[model samples]
Target: MAVPNAASHLDFVVDPEHPDAEPFYAPSKRNYPQAVKGFYRSIKWAALVATLATYYLLPFVRWNRGPGAPGQAVLLDLADRRFYFFFVEIWPQEAYYVAGLLVLAALVLFMMNALAGRVWCGYLCPQTVWTDLFFAVERRFEGDLHARRAREAKGWTFDRAWRLVAKHATWVLIAWWTGGAWVLYFSDAPTLVRALATLQAPAIAYVWIGILTFTTYALAGHMREQVCVYMCPWPRIQAALTDEWALNVTYRTDRGEPRLSLKKSHAARSRGEPAGDCVDCRQCVAVCPTGVDIRDGLQLGCIQCGLCIDACDAVMSKVGRPARLIAYDTDMNVARRAEGKPALRRLVRPRTILYAVAIAAVGSLMLWRLTTRPGGALAIAHDRNPLSVTLADGSIQNGYSALVINRDAAPRTFDLSASGVPGAKLVVEGAPSDGTRVRIQVPGDDTREVRVLLRAAAPSGAATSVPVTFTVVNETSGETATATDRFETPAAN
Candidate 1:
């Protein structure tokens, strides 16, 4: 079977001899990547284990929040409109912190791409990680590439049928597990686990799990390379962002040109004829997850995984040739080597520095905001209808809604006062008030909405609107929060 190169849209070859030979499209074939062992493979294994372990286990970890607060280390509490991550808790009003995290992630990805092309795609992408795991299961059930191919050639036998069944069964199991692990993040893991086990979990949770299971199974098992090659937009974006200085999985064509078989190369060298180091073995292609021929030059299908590098190095060692026939190299370096110039590496270029600075700045800003944020908040809104009421006592009263947020672990009373309105008496709808301030209580880690009325003697020839400051002081800790709104009065005719 011929594996169609994803780099080419047409997947057809033009014959130079005929000049006008009719091109015929070749259909893509399923890739059965052969297993290979080397340094890069070891790194990939370690990364796979670490990432999967984190995903499956992090939800089970607990945090020690005070009583009346959820203790999940990381959770999105939709009911309470709060997001908690360890010691940090974000209210709905603080959504900018989440946006900052997203921005920081993008900046870090850009920096990684500037340093090494598609490194994130190759190593840490969810698609790649899941697909690699699926492939491992397939290999375990059906044997390696050669054995599977041989079995396919012999047609479907009982052995092959059973192996296929086992492979697909394992794939579905893993997909289910992956989906199940994801839902644990949104709730208390142990509680959710018991609910799920007892079949008492929420219908929405089960629906989400089913959706995720189907997606994971279909994408990782069947649409593995297709997702990377056709579905994802990152490859196109990365191509636009990359420059010549970026390190990519590249073939050193200068050293391996005029490819020949080992026996032919040996004879040619004996006759003092030109011969390249590459023995023309297709091991690199066989081991590539996307089945890309690295010798065909850098391609969109090449994920920069460095597996081809490992495969080529092993072959080179066996053939007694110097390694790194394929390596993490820049196009400029390849051109330099071809032109007999010393290869130059510019790791700290302006693009990388800019991305690094952006990541650092965003991360620092989010951290500073989180650390310095106050434990209380206040918001006030002036009533629109009947902005002000004229009482019989010749006083103007403005109605307002005040939301007081207490972020502390203990219940606290707040003294709410109004400023900017001279001789104003502040009153809470249900609470007692002194002439100057109203006292209201808020529960720990909760918000209280209170109707507030500010009354002042109507000034003669007074402005129609006056800016009023609403201040809430915590009676226990003396922490304060304030909001400003306009107190409207009747216009003087």
Candidate 2:
């Protein structure tokens, strides 16, 4: 042995700057997930294709709403205060529907969580889908995990430099298109597309597109699993929500204990010694997008994508052992197997049943409300300051404001009438010269506010405040809407 160099003298003691002495929570290590091919991998690929197609194509779908209304099916017309989704149209006054929809979405997520842990994170989330797309592009240009790692070790060459350029350029294009698709939902898709191409679109649209493009490229392409691990709060919330019965990506430690290499396992079997089929392979870790080793037990880094199951299955097949050494199972089931007891599947437990019932109840209530909705709406506001006025003819007059909402698809006149005291005549200040009980025309899918004067013969001994009923009847459809307000009077002078 040769004598130690000057650098070796301080090696015996811990160095604060050394990696081994650093804290456990170090900066994220870049993950180059190896390509996997199996059942779970196939399912992920299908999900990626379906979700991306829907995002890129749904804005182009069209729906006709008679005349002077948006033709795009899912437009959010902020300028006109309307939200259109296929056959449904929501006005600003009906904002409760949006709250209902958000509640429904939350309940659906809870029900899904009760059945399986974080399935949304694995397959349906936008982050997961876009990240998968970026990964595919990277792999196509840079080869697989081993090749990428080797290339990194050898430093950048001419071929590597070109591949990096092509990969980042593709990512930018996809990000730009994602932003472009988002803006199409706010205006007529074809018209906006032409405007965007001709550089005539509004400055706000371009600004939003630029913001989204940068965020998408940074989050999905550069941040990758860091977003899932550190940025998102779902992983922490999910861990608390998950029950012992909920199926999750799990490794069967009972089958994997006493791990040995392939040769050692075969030798142990021949000698009738205990041996596991794990074979000490790191395929599960290699295929993990987040670089989590499932054998290390569940943690926040695990997205429950099931790629480890595919990797482990392939390894098992090569070793002539049973599959599912890593699969979707519960921790309780894993413990049961270790104890030589029958595994339990409690999918229909009390919590899950309660969640399912809540979902059904909310859905049914929303459906019933939608089916029985009125054709229009009405509101009345009595004058605040001059509550009552005494006319020269001993008649009591009440000034009021009336708003009529037309929910149908065609313009129509509404017959207005007021009743409470006898001989009460309703007069529209600027409407047609029809004496009392005049008709006012309201535009289709719009609200009209107008001033109204209510006159009635003064009763000698009436109460100070009188309740009045205002009704608007649709002339063409015979549909009616009503509102009630109180008219106030002072003591007789």
Q: Quick one: RMSD of model 1?
A: 4.4
- Which candidate tops lDDT? 1
lDDT by residue (tens digit), candidate 2, 1-493: 1233434444545466783673434455677899999998899999999999988898899888888888888999988888999988888877888988989998888878878888899888899999999999999999998788778777869888999999999999999999999998888889999999999999989998999899999999999899999989988888888888888999888888788999998899899999987888999999899999988899898888999999999999998899999999997898888889999998899988998898898888877876776777788998877788988887878898898889887888898887776777778888973545779898988889999988877755767777888888888988888999975565422
Candidate 2: misplaced stretches above 4 Å? 1-26, 268-271, 379-401, 417-428, 432-438, 452-469, 483-493
Provide the TM-score for each candidate, comma-separated: 0.89, 0.86
Q: Work out how many backbone clashes candidate 2 has.
A: 0
Best by TM-score: 1
lDDT of 2: 0.86
Under the 3 Å rule for N, CA and C atoms, how many clashes does model 1 have?
0
Candidate 1 residue-wise lDDT, 1-493, digit = tens:
4566543665346555664555553455799999999988898999899999999999988899988799899998888889999999999878899899889888888888999999998999999999999999999999998899899888879999999999999999999999999899888999999999999999888998998899999999998988888889999999999999999999888999789999999999999998898899999999999989999998898888999999999999999999999999998898899889999999998998899888888988899988987778898988888889899998998889999998998888998888998899888889999979888899999999999999998754657888899988988888888899987886622
lDDT of 2 at 343: 93
